[model samples]
Target: MNKTIFITGTSSGIGQATAQYFEAQEWNVIATMRSPEKQNILKNSERMLVLKLDVEKPETFNEVIEKAIAHFGKIDVLLNNAGYGQHGLFEATTSEQIHRQFSVNLFGTMEITRALLPHFRAQKNGSIITITSGVGRVTVPLVSIYAASKFALEGFCESLSFELASQNIQVKIIEPGNIATNFEQTTKSNFAADEALTDYSDYLKKMDEVFKGIYSGGGSTAADVAATIFKAANDESNVLRYVVGSDLQPLIDIRNGGTDEQYMDVLRSTFVPEN
Candidate 1:
């Protein structure tokens, strides 16, 4: 029997690419997004079922998961791919934005995984893959809150990996440095700003340039990440983290290979150079 992979955030970017990649590889795919009515790109796709799934809405999760399983027989993998980064100075960001950021990025992943745990536990076999970012393991200016969410997710998966290991359930996280996708554009366009704080205006403008050079200077494509996810899904290893994006790898190395102070200095020199 063909394996089924249920994925969230399939409307665009890495999620869309991964759904396509898996379908081409002959796997059953549950390609879910917030607004399924607005998509037709995968309308005629064979062996792929596109559905509505807004991760922020936990109330709707169980229904979607049940529908996916009923349609595909059984799901072998769960790809937590639906999330957005809330970008801005911490003070500039509102509580609502922070709640929404974590709601989808961290909480949504947790809730969905919780809903699926019973199914996987009973089978005693499964893979849970989450797409976090390179910043999850490090940090950068202008994205403090975004980094926090990913960081929480990283820790969550790391701990859950051990709990699920005995049952043959693999918990994996994909950390991409930066990617050439509309993901960045969407993040920037929707960034929250507190206009009342004019004092930080100049700093914000400068950080914009810093973010561009650091995040978009060079990175991987959504397809590259999709390929990496495929490899991780099939590897059946006890390993937990898989890093993608060539541009982000070196920074991860800096974090992995040195002391916290040294890594902070490197970031400071790179983004906050003293004048």
Candidate 2:
């Protein structure tokens, strides 16, 4: 029997690619987005069932999960791939933005995973894959809040993997570097600041420039990330995390091999000093 995978944020990017990849392999793909009424390529596929799912709305999980199980009979995988980036200096970010970012990225993912845990526990075998980022492992300028939320996920998934081991539930996180996606264009900027932060405008501008270059096909493709997620989902060994993209490999090597001083030097060299 073909396995069923429930993926969030399927309107585009890695989620969409993952949906296509699995469908090509004859697996049932439940691709979800906040608005299913929107025209999408996945909507036309016989193997794909595009559902409505807003991660922030925890109330929708039960109904959505029921629909998924009914459509595919059983869900072998749950991909928590829905999230957005909030770019701004820590000081410039409002409380609302911080809460919103965490809500959608961290808490929302957690809620959905929690809701599905019982089903996975009952089945005694399942995969929970989350789309985290390299920033989760290392900090970056102007993305402190976004990094924090992913960092929270990394820690949560790591611990959850251990806890769910007895039930044969696999918890994996995909930490990819910048990937080519509409994520940058969809990113909400909250950099509005008063006169006191005028000195940091150039640094913020530089960060925006980097995002444009990184997300516009200059970095890894969405398929690259989807492949990583598929590997983590299908792998027999209980690996905790999979880092995707060549751009991230060097940084991971540095993090794993470099000394403290080297790490600090690299950070300083890459990020412009805030004057």
Candidate 3:
């Protein structure tokens, strides 16, 4: 029987690329997004099934999962890719933005995976792949809420991997550095900030300049991330985290090589200016 992978946030970027990759590999692909009506690129693909799934809406998860399984007979993998960035200073972020950030990234990812656990346990086999960010490990300025959510996911999946191992289910996290995606625009749209707070004016200016440099520097392509996720999905071993993009490896090493204070010093030197 052909394997089936259910991926969320497939409207664009790595999610869409992975759906295409698996479909080409002759796997049944459930490519879901907030609006299935907007996805025209992969609808016609031979083994692809585009569905609607908004991670923010926990009420809709069971229905989507049921439809995916009814169509494919079973789900071999679940890719938690439906998430966005909410960037700005911690003080500038509103209560609503904070809730929404965790709601979509951390809470929703958990909810959807819970909805699928019963089925995976019944089948006694499955893999769960989540697209977390490198910011989950090495945090920078202007993305506090975004980084928090990703960091939570990294911890969540690492622990979940151990629990799911007993049931013959594998849990994995994909941490990719800044990829070439429409996410920059999405981040702008999702942002909340108090422009009138001049206390951090110079700090904000420097942060903006640093972010522009990072985005422009170009770390990884969406295809690169997709390929990494593919490798993780196919991996039968119990490995839990797959860091994508060559540029992120050195940073990951630095973060894992030393104590928390050491990583803090490194982060401060990179993003904080000397006065």
Which regions of candidate 1 are displaced past 4 Å? none
The CA lDDT at 76 in model 3 is: 92
Winner by lDDT between candidate 2 and candidate 1: 1
lDDT of 1: 0.89
**Each model's lDDT:** 0.89, 0.85, 0.88
Candidate 2, residues 1-275, lDDT tens digits: the string is: 88989999888888889999988878889998998788447874667888999999999899999988987788999999999888766787789989999999999999999999988988889999998999998777778889999999999999988988889898888998878777766665444355588877677678777666655647788998887887887898967879888778788788789797898788787675545
Q: Which residues of candidate 3, in runs, are more than 4 Å off?
A: none
TM-score of predicted model 2? 0.93
Give the clash total for candidate 1.
Answer: 0
| Tens-digit per-residue lDDT, 1-275, candidate 3 | 89999998889988988988888778999998998787678794558888888988889899989988888899999999989899987888999999999998999899999999999999999999999999998888889999999999999998998899999999989999878888889888867778788888888788888788877888788988888888998999878888888778888898889998898898898688876
- For all predictions, the C-alpha RMSD in Å is 1.4, 2.1, 1.3
* TM-score, cand. 1: 0.96
TM-score of each: 0.96, 0.93, 0.96
TM-score winner between 1 and 2, please give it.
Answer: 1
**How well is each residue in 1-275 modelled by candidate 1, as lDDT tens digits?**
99999999999899999999999999999998999888777663668999998888889988998998888888899999999888878988888889889999999999999999999988889999999998898788888899999999999999999988988899999998788899888987978788898988777777877776676477799999999999998987777899997777788888889999998889888677454
